[model samples]
Target: MPSSFCYKVLVCFLLTYSVQYMGFGRVELNAQEGYIFENPYQKTEKQTDVTSFTIYFNQKSSQIPKSDEVRLQSVADFLNQNRNYEIYIEAHAVDGKNYKEDILISEKRSLEVERFLLIHFVEEGQIRRLFYGNSKSPNRTKAHAALNRRVEIRLQQKN
Candidate 1:
């Protein structure tokens, strides 16, 4: 074989192999946006089974009622019957607080509900969704924010 021909063949093979072996470039994940493909935060439907219940805070009550023992008991009964269901506790405050504090307040309210459920027999894993809505709007009256300081539970459909 001619040396030049051999050289050409070797060069072609090298170029082709290198191209196949090398990827385009480094890929970085950032928090600015959510990704579906490589999502570490994604919850499987099995893990996300949810149930929701709402509490209406009465503005005039002046004092928030002890976490609704009756309602929580009902939730406990439901959970006992339907072990497949998971509860999501959400807390919402009437939109009367300063904007900066709404998220914090809402989250606290949600956590409080979670605490009450925990005091009962609900498993922590069963409750996957937790959120707070500080009165963005008067969907529930400010007077009722305490009552509105409620928890919602949802059932995650099996995937």
Candidate 2:
């Protein structure tokens, strides 16, 4: 059995959630100091969380840097555990205005990443490679070229 105040809080919470979900209006709690209004609807623990590593590459180089070498083990472990998910390796390089070189380097970068996963015993069937090279970039400035020189790894569920 719940107390009257607890029951009232539950009712208020449900009403607030329902109204917010339907785009009606937001409920202002006007909470006081020392009182933390935590969201009860959200998960208290992370859901099936897998480590996300930011794998970066050197300028015009496909070799994985020493800083990111250690993180690849965690990625391999996760992929091995989640056989239903496929990992995507998207490789990119700095824009040198030479499409041929850019494409070649990017393809090499993706293969390098795939090689690491393969060495760790992750199934080859679970990997997808996409090489964008210099065709795609966040910016055209030399200062931001480092941002483009990298590989992005993503996981997707198998159909």
Assess each prediction's global lDDT (C-alpha) against the native: 0.56, 0.77
Q: Please give, for residues 11-127, the per-residue lDDT of candidate 1 as tens digits.
A: 999999988768556678675321123235632121112245455454322122444444566676677677787776655654445655656656666666667667777778776
Give the TM-score of each candidate.
0.50, 0.65
Stretches of candidate 2 off by over 4 Å are 1-53, 95-97
Best by TM-score: 2
Question: Residue by residue across 26-108, what tens digits does model 2's lDDT show?
Answer: 67868543222234552223223344434667777888875455566667898899999888888888745588888999999
The clash numbers for all candidates, in the given order, read: 19, 0
